[model samples]
Target: MTKRQQLEMDRGQDGSDSVHPLHNVSSDRSLTVYPRGDGQLVVETETLGHLTPRRTHGTDEGRTDAKLPDRPSVHGLSPDLLVPQPATLEPLDQHIRSHTGYPDIIYQATLIPPANFAMVAPFVYRSSFPLKKNFPFLLKLGIKSILTLILEDYPVQNVKFLRENGIRLFQFGVPGNKEPFVDIPQDMIAAALATLLDRRNHPILIHCNKGKHRTGCLVGCLRRLQHWSLTAIFEEYRTFSAPKSRHMDQQFIELFNMAHVGPLIDTNHLPPWPTLL
Candidate 1:
């Protein structure tokens, strides 16, 4: 091909172009292509009905991942049960442990609700006392073990830390910034549960700072997953956190109803929802 032809192909202006990074790109936008020789790249636009989005989305906007290096124990307490802050909700930490910090508790409440599929909880939120310590006690006291979590850029360190100390974690990453949000693949959560040796344990805990928005969304997902009624969820979470984390409860309820279907997510202990409409 001539140099001019090659340039046109690279610009995605020629009909004959095969591997332009942004296929059918607009003139004002250009995409740099680094192929398998570097890193394969492509871009494309989709129509939303008759309206064009006329907007850009992030490439790795709200990505959450595994692992972190263990940090020094905060407060005067040992690295046992801690309440990382930005949490305005009731102090479950005083009941569970003695230490606390604000921005330090990344995704602290990620245990699943009596199911194994929500292991991301411990990983996303690192703490000293494992949720395992609280589960049996909660159950003996007649509270259903339920935890809801939401976090961002959650570390794998939390996951490894919780596991080393005999705790199960559950985290679902929804990528975005601020109130305007987009979802990353939380389906990997179900995959995490499938790998666990046991699936029917209880006294699960889930958290996000303040145990409000993200925690709420997760409880909603779990309620739908286990076929529990919204009323049951509100009550269960209230029982665990005591004074009741109602904002979390309601937020989760909104998210659950958003799906408009009953496909169960906690497939480890609960059978899959029948996909009912």
Candidate 2:
């Protein structure tokens, strides 16, 4: 399977230049192995052939300044070739803080969670766009997949990190709710919900730019699937998107078409959420 699978929705406007972007989408499912457990990535060292020679002391040989004989060769190759090169001279603290390179400093790393991060269920989490610093915290979660709602190309740094870590990306791009475009396409949300219901995507992280409007809408709809009361759902939604909660997002959750989403779910692999109907 490919590293990233992107599904997008097309806004059927008559070629009008609205602030929000629109693209076409299709309903299709992809599968990949979900790797678990914590294992360190092994970094290979370069073989270095150079060896410093030692001279004998307090002997006739020392007066002549002759070098010591080389160690025995293995398979016609010098044993010194088996020795690895020394590490670079960069400082430890600066390397970890700058995120300029991956070094052994991660052994003593500080894991920093993303903004507005919270656990939605046993294996699911929600957060704002993850930064380089947030990667250590994500590693600890053992994230198997990521579901992103931002309507832009994933960052190169993030894509590289995900590729290196064996995490799959399911990108369903959609614009955030803005005035006059309060309608978030139901088909996109329904498709996203179908993906969320499958246990294969567990240990998933749902995110948008700020984890406020778009993320809140998706989580609210999920609460609806779990048979949560609208009152409670709205309360939780407000907690994350407090100062800038959008009424349109709440409306989308209340009126989300469960009938459209139900048929798309694979009942055999549904998550073990008791309240899921």
Using TM-score, give the best candidate's number: 2
lDDT of 1 by residue, 203-269 (tens): 3454555544444444445455555776776665554444645453355354544342324334455
Alpha-carbon TM-score of each model against the true structure: 0.29, 0.61
Positional deviation of residue 107's Cα in model 1 after best superposition, in angstroms: 32
* RMSD score of candidate 2 (Å): 29.1
- State the lDDT of candidate 2 residue by residue for 1-277, as single tens digits: 3322221111233343221211111123221221112211121112243222212322422222232234465445322233322342245455343433445565667889999999999899999999999998999999999999988999999999999999999999978878884568888998988888888988999999999999999999999988899999999999999898988888889988788887788998888886465
- Return the TM-score for candidate 1, rounded to 2 decimals: 0.29
User: What is the alpha-carbon lDDT of model 1 when measured against the actual structure?
Assistant: 0.39
Alpha-carbon local distance difference test for all models? 0.39, 0.73
Clashes of 2: 2
